[model samples]
Target: MPGLTFEKLLLIAIIAVFVLGPEKLPHYAAQLARLVKSLKNMASGAKDRLRDEMGPEFNDVDWQKLDPRQYDPRRIIREALLDDEGAAAPVAVKPPTRSRPVESAAQKRLGLAEAGAAAPFDSEAT
Candidate 1:
């Protein structure tokens, strides 16, 4: 984009003037103007065709809501496939429960802990 600045465009024009002398420069400039105008017309035609095909509903749809960042990951993917009516059930994340008393592996190997006793890690071993 920076290359399209006024200074760069002037540099390009100077180069083109040298390459295609004064007599041909004007002709090529006119051709370039026509090319740019035709490209803009083509883009407008495509947009008009889309509007015709989709009708009024095209403008009514909420494009921002359909964007993925607006919804939870699971709900968005599920919604795309029409797999559910209600929002996806919230996923619960927690550590696995340990019912018995806990001890470090080093404590058991060295016979340093009694049964059913929670022990801090061995400082030296750690």
Candidate 2:
């Protein structure tokens, strides 16, 4: 049913008539119809059994809300990380501040300054 439109069904029927021939086609077609009907009945019977086992809870359940297809990974993670009231708490951001560079003795010996500018070099030190 998903991919089979009326035109596609007609084309398949035409091909089947040639391949199976008119006499055997009817028999196969009837078998196919029975198979589809049985499958539908099986699915409905399963639902009915589940409903009977669950009682009133089955009817009360929100099927759409419980559907796996409706879930989003990002949204689920976000909701889990949210506060108790369901609203997302505002995040406090610290303002960017200029931090003083820590210059080690080795860096100073190498003539590297705090601001990354090269210190005055003595030719003899090399």
Best by TM-score: 2
Q: Check candidate 1 and list the clashing pairs.
A: none
**Per-residue lDDT of model 1, residues 1-126, tens digit only:** 544888898999999999999999999999999999999999999989988999998899888878876779787687776766675677798976887657678888877568755556788995
Judged by whole-model lDDT over C-alpha atoms, candidate 2 comes out at 0.87
lDDT (C-alpha) at residue 51 in model 2: 96
Count of clashing residue pairs in every prediction: 0, 0
Worst 10 residues of 2 by lDDT: 80-89
| Global fold similarity of model 1 (TM-score) | 0.47
Q: How well does candidate 2 score on lDDT at residue 110?
A: 74
Q: List CA RMSD, all candidates.
A: 13.1, 13.9
Q: Against the hidden reference, what TM-scores do the models get?
A: 0.47, 0.55
What is the C-alpha local distance difference test score of each model?
0.84, 0.87
